[model samples]
Target: MPEKKLNQKRKEFNKEKMVGIWSLVSLEVTDENGQKTYPMGEDATGFIMYHPEGYMSAQIMQSGRPQYASGEVLCGTQEEMAAASNGYLAYAGPYQVDEINKMVTHHMAVSLYPNWLGDTQPRYLDIKGDTLEITSQPVFFNGKEHNTKLIWKRVS
Candidate 1:
């Protein structure tokens, strides 16, 4: 085989290797302090559905009871939290995967962060059998870049 052909085949193989729905059967996210890690409870499960349509669905379980935010913003302000508690249980979205870079970029979200409507976030993922290691180098939250790491195990 020609050198160019061989390279192309390698690229194709890498792309095909990462195509699938990786469920978050289990998860552990480290806090900003980095001194401790938080593990999701048994009820804390989610899924990331990757589609050939250049999109994906990423959803995570809500914590505790519902907490609805006051005003138009889905996220309740400190004041709003005191008024009512109506949040969410689970949310999903569309996404695209760049196999070459091992990065999965989300196109649109259907839950969780509504402000991320059309925003795109690229997540670096390392998959080992049913286990997945997700590292978010600098995710902007509340106008601050947060270093986050997440590990998930496939239950289904």
Candidate 2:
């Protein structure tokens, strides 16, 4: 192929690269004291997807969540429901990509945590072939402030 054609092809390829389903590899939280922790446990799991229509969805959960004794979806006691919610994180909304800056902003239209609704968060991104890493600004979680770094591998 001609040099110009090759360059154009590469650009197109890059644009489509971010649109796919990705599996979580790891999630790390760093505190002000430089201590690192995994809020979802060492074996946490999740998936994040970017659709062609400018929408995205992400879900993360701690491994081995407990089942409520009631067995019914809506019959869980307050404690059971709290445990389930505390172990999971999920949100979906339209997203904007700034490829030149290696950043993406997620506009949260729906979220498992009510406080996150209508929030727009910008995340720095580093994408290499099938792997993607995203880092966020400091966020207050369960009281203390921390920053998050998440690594994901393309699954589709």
Candidate 3:
């Protein structure tokens, strides 16, 4: 192999090593419809840490009032945010990193969400430095679609 090619491969390998444990510090979500937008503040925040043991876990809190499957938007209530995120805490199972595709896939989600209560496909992963931003895109539940984002910071 050429020296340049070997160096490139080494760099790619190094980036994967950076995918270790991380903690959640803060997060913000924006719901946009063309020109109108809303910021779901700090309620949707938590820590997510990945282990070399082939598993990762996350806990997220809904910060602002966002619509739930029950056809209700919390709208400026912490209790509502907490209730909305009841199943979002302590989700774990296994994960895989795809460097060439710039993707990370999570499987077997032991989460509170009924839709993800069992094995699942890769939902989201965009890692850079000490931050790993993962999202579960809009999914249709009860004939409605909702988009969400979860952010975490490296602690270990």
Candidate 4:
């Protein structure tokens, strides 16, 4: 977090380690008092992929989302569509890794949430064996600041 540390080049950390598809394990949000909660339920499912071409994509959602009564993809009414969006998140864009900081920055060129479009977010990355842990910077939402930690496992 220091200024000098940010300028140092990474020695052993390689950006290549991040290139792979990962299955979501868990996403935990912790508040200031250390109380943790799951934003998409405890058994949420999703995938995050880091492409070799310096790009990344992540899609996450609560499992067992209600299906529209029409059984059609595009026929969902406003209420149905809003419910779907409320339970899902997705984004993709070129990414950059700052190995010194053990961080990866997701430049949101596109996202399901409009506010995230063109937003750049830095996530701390810790990869061990086949597991990758990405911790977000403190985020203020839902009336409180929280830290989110997402765990993932390599699938390919």
Q: Estimate each model's TM-score.
A: 0.59, 0.87, 0.60, 0.91
Tell me the tens digit of each residue's lDDT in model 2 across 127-153: 888998999978887778999999999
Scored by lDDT, the top model is 4
Position 108, candidate 4: lDDT: 99
Per residue, candidate 3 scores C-alpha lDDT tens digits across 1-156 of 798877775565443564566666555443443221223344445666667777877666545534654555545367656655652455778887765444567775687666777766665566667677766666554455555556677777
Q: List the residue pairs that clash in candidate 1.
A: 55-95, 56-94, 56-95, 67-85, 67-86, 67-87, 68-85, 68-86, 68-87
C-alpha displacement of 30 in model 4, angstroms? 0.3
lDDT of 4 by residue, 1-156 (tens): 676655554544668888999999999999988899998989999999999999999999999999999999899989999999999989999999988878999999989999999999999999888999999999897788999999999999
Clashes within 3 Å, all models in order: 9, 0, 7, 0
Model 3: weakest 10-residue lDDT segment is: 31-40
Worst 10-residue lDDT window for candidate 1 reads 82-91
Question: Judged by lDDT relative to the true structure, which candidate is superior, 1 or 4?
Answer: 4
Model-by-model lDDT, in order? 0.58, 0.91, 0.60, 0.92
State residue 38's C-alpha deviation in candidate 1, in Å: 3.1
lDDT of 1 by residue, 89-155 (tens): 2345666666556777766656555676767667887777666667776655555455655556654
Q: How many Å off is the CA of 129 in candidate 3?
A: 2.3
Q: Model 2: how far is 84 from its true place, Å?
A: 0.3
